[model samples]
Target: MAFFTKEQAKAAARRSENMLDQVAGLESYSDERFDVFLSHSMLDQDLVVGVAMLLKEQGYSVYIDWVEDEELDREHVDKETAERLRQRMRNCSSLIYIATDRSGQSKWMPWELGYFDGYKDGGVAILPLVDTVNSGFDGQEYLGLYPLVNQVNQRLYVEDASKVHSDFWAFVNDPSR
Candidate 1:
């Protein structure tokens, strides 16, 4: 079956061109305000919250899925929540995945990484971190991250908050990225 009509493709092309013009208009202050989505595991909850607070303090609209409490009756990492988080990521200008050595052990984290991998090829900006690499680190499934690594624009150490923001802003302004 055909994925898109010829006319639909042409309209999409036109919309992309218009978006370029809009992006050019916001080139100056792109860093001050951007659509950001945070993909992180529960193990890294503290780090995610800290980053969210910092971004909010800087006046950015950050979408952190784990920041809000989930319904107790439903499975915390069920399909519903994943889809909601995926929607938020799709709407954002950038995606940030908080990586810890323990990330590989969790079933949901790898699934989330797969979602980010798809976005990277679509020209979405992705930023990932390697917080630690010990016993905890060895347990991490670096294999899962291999596909997205090439798409990563910045590989900051987890402790570096300033660097994360800097890279995030850079992605926001980079037209080719």
Candidate 2:
């Protein structure tokens, strides 16, 4: 499957900002249950916004920390912040770890992935971003263990080494999972 390139994602992000009320993270508040709990490095804010836009366009509701939790500070971690994040994670049906060049440096992405995988079971996937469209993911070692999110013809799918690309929803809700 073709992956999203950084340039394409940025363009999509700009379009999302101009077409909607705002960019993915700056959009109006959402109090409803989220389809995805997006886990990514704050350093990839622009990329995250773009990725969220793609998800939103595909009819998925995404939960972004900066957009939903303005009170929490990443630099100064506290019990309240962790607790609040956990609570939010519970409200989301699935988690999408956006694996970028900076993902390995993040402190929360791995924890969020593990937490969602354990508590929700089969509700976790990785969306890898590359410098070019045909390029592949080269993130942390363990990231390959989970299904990798992919986009083809603007539709999302998840694939692992042992299986072909599966429907995004079906992959997350697989009964065998």
Give lDDT tens digits, candidate 1, residues 38-118.
666666554555555444544556655433323322344566666765665556666655444445556665566567557
User: Which lDDT value does model 1 have at 166?
Assistant: 31
Clashing pairs in 2: none
Q: Each candidate: what lDDT?
A: 0.44, 0.80
lDDT of 2 by residue, 1-177 (tens): 777787877987887775334433453334456888999999998898888888888788778888777656877999888887888887888899988898889999998998888888878888888998889777788887888888878778898878678899776455654
Clashes of 1: 0
Task: Say which candidate scores most in TM-score.
Answer: 2
- What lDDT is obtained when candidate 2 is compared to the true structure? 0.80
Candidate 1 matches the true fold with a TM-score of 0.50
* Candidate 1, position 84, lDDT: 61
Q: Tell me each candidate's TM-score.
A: 0.50, 0.88
Model 1 lowest lDDT segment of ten: 149-158
